[model samples]
Target chain A: MTDQTTNWPDHLTGDAQPLEVGILLYEGHTALDLVGPYTTFALAGMKVHLVAETLDPVVSDDGGMTIAPTTTFDDCPERLDILFVPGGGMVYKPMLDPATIAWLADRGATASYITAVCNGPLVLAAAGLLDGYRVATHWASRDQLARLGVEVSTERVCIDRNRFSGGGVTAGIDFGLTVVAHTLGEKAARFAQLVMEYDPEPPFNAGSPESAGPEIVALRTRFMAEPDTALRNAVSHVLEQRAATSSHPVSDENADPAAGIVND
Target chain B: MTDQTTNWPDHLTGDAQPLEVGILLYEGHTALDLVGPYTTFALAGMKVHLVAETLDPVVSDDGGMTIAPTTTFDDCPERLDILFVPGGGMVYKPMLDPATIAWLADRGATASYITAVCNGPLVLAAAGLLDGYRVATHWASRDQLARLGVEVSTERVCIDRNRFSGGGVTAGIDFGLTVVAHTLGEKAARFAQLVMEYDPEPPFNAGSPESAGPEIVALRTRFMAEPDTALRNAVSHVLEQRAATSSHPVSDENADPAAGIVND
Candidate 1:
């Protein structure tokens, strides 16, 4: 028997493993989008696996936190209480690749719950997992999500059943906490929140892409538009790929590493 | 002239050397307390150095984010803008260690600013920097600061001249953004905040030491009582250390690794 506290309930008749969480890591992804929730849920003692298309070290959106992934998408066990997705640079190839998108579309239906943080919901939209669901994406990409028939919101986090979304990188922490409460019940979640002391007080009180004054918002908006279009094109390709095949289109044997290297 | 964005005419400049941001690592430090801010600042493209009594990787309160120090107290540079103290675990020894406390005491006069997240201000208090300043620590540790003549507050972040304190670990991001604003201007800070999408909406809207339900709060209050005693004892020792020293007692002998242990 392991000595992990909460690992084993002394009175339970059958043995149970802690919920395994798989967080997707891709090149140029927002480190905060993943690290924020990674810290929150891991602190709550969930079994988290940082999974990537391959086991290579994934570079973050910025240049820091060069995280070497723990498992490839193919090798990760099928069981997961939550599948967390983090977004960063416009790495659209993974979502655009026919085989990869087919894999996401296949497993997503059977996964415990799937979530996207920041632009990560783009991947979900590509997988056809977000159709008709109210979702949230980063401010820059919200319109693109809307175009795909996903009910997009400006809220920090929007949850529609097993599909979850977050506004931007920082919102992932809150989204992670929300799921913690949803999965572990109030007591455990409350304890985890207290330990984190998750209340925020931004000095300038400006966070939204819109509310960040006119100039800065306009600048980022323009800079991000081109990349968004490119990503949208990629997702559209995947939607067509899913339509061509009714069976699970993605297979471990077919996930192409070349699907990496997009706008990032 | 460095090409770094922080080197702009509006930005502050010094040596062309790497921008040094020190995270004071100690045993039992909260993982996110340091990791959260570390991820943010590191992702911001800052040169982050984890400093400790010895260059051993420090273990966090939750045994997550085990990190090796880039240097030790002695080797840390003389001038720095961001001096981060992360809270959790046995802070008493490092706070009282003449080397660590003296280094802080000497630099406290010229540092760009000294900031603490969660109970970290206790270390600042140990150095006597918080004697007359308004400060905040982990909710449980506020009373401990009051005993040292610190004007304690319930605020998530208490920003006095050259001194910044947050309620606990999760406040690190907002505190970090606030520090960025103080160092840089509103525009740069806003850009960073926007890039990060600093929107925060928690799942249950409960994230304070006091905000958790009565049962969890009571349980935590009961659980923390014992550790708080250790913290008090450490505080007393630190006070004595300060009394024994005239001024600037910490040695800048160059950072040294702890004996018998090696960093990975």
Candidate 2:
């Protein structure tokens, strides 16, 4: 029963109830994308649920490892404080699955905060949840996300109103900390940060395209091509279906105001 | 079949056989500690296996999520290119388990490289693997690790010959990348970095005790006190058992030479 949150200072927790976080899990969802944020939320005394369609295990996109879901979509709490999604190779699979998209749409509508990392925003966009919010996603998927009618930012962590998005895989940690700061206060996030030892020293400076130089960037571009194309094609299909159902939604007036977006 | 490794430039992979990496998993291993490095190894075309005592789902220390192991201690390959362990609250459980220690001792003898992150080094040392090697662990457990007759370092990533270790939780990503650089090549590790978008921008500058400031450091110290004491007691018990079985092994003559250690 003793945990990092066991003797959480009353001043840090204040009157805040433990945030209920529902992280969507599906076939091929990347493990780190979910885990980085999950750790931050869990350590900060948030209730995180790995929400999947069934009780069956969800295999990661990386292959080999599988994570069991804590709750099924049907069994998840009707209202969540945070609705999160993680990106991966087959994110398109979930984007096209009506059941998954419907669940995302339903939960995202009332969730206090909508969050995602990497290509996760694409799934949110597919559900029409990110229509007017500027979000961040993996650099490789930014273009594709823009094609979904979602304004994409290049920052590692982007916050627009209640939408919190992170760029690529590791950015989930930063994104999660930012969310904790917003929800619980900077002190609580700092406590989680210390617990996680978030100080990073990447062996190489190739995390972003601009810094990775030409050769490495070209190689990663080639490597990401197929999956990128698949995601693009899936987004086009979603757009076409949306077009057929309803034309010209998410008006300029509905766009999240410029003041709400935090580029940092 | 097309993965990031598809068409991997011949020069990057060269004549290297895919690395066989076995990451230890137990009931309460931290998810990020495993996933961070697992992502790097998996992306670098390494055959990373989640090894456990049995094939059942292993719950994480943070709670909620459960990861299914790919191989059991009894079934894992006899020799591994890399043997890895992840840190968590209950790392002591594995450190005290004879079957797990025996298996690690068996594998560590011949693994091309032995690696750990966070308090994972304690588990490795408990198995009599890190004896005399300068290793790194979570800052909170550095004192505990040193008690196991292992030389400890404060660096985020420490490399002593074939022993590669890392600091707490998030440091696993950096540790894994370093291992990839040593095994495959720097270019290969760089490619994985780009694939992961490893750039980290912490919302707050409070990851290390040095930067976390005194107040946050105090909070984390208090939060970690119980677990730290438990690990210290476990390490003492392990040393007692080791002393009772074999008196004063790993002598000065057996110490890894100065040239083998990479402080950075």
RMSD of 1: 9.1
Each prediction's DockQ against the real complex: 0.39, 0.67
TM-score of chain A of each: 0.80, 0.88
Best by the TM-score measure: 2
Predicted candidate 1: interface RMSD?
A: 3.1
Fnat for candidate 1 (0 to 1):
0.59
Candidate 2 ranges with C-alpha deviation above 4 Å:
A1-16, A247-264, B1-16, B248-264
For candidate 1, write residues B84-114 as lDDT tens digits. 8888866666666677777778767667778
Candidate 1, residue B254: Cα displacement in angstroms equals 35
Please, what are the lDDT tens digits per residue for candidate 2 over residues A47-66?
A: 89999999999999867779
DockQ score for candidate 1 = 0.39
Candidate 1 residue B14 C-alpha distance from true site, Å: 14
Please give each candidate's TM-score. 0.75, 0.90
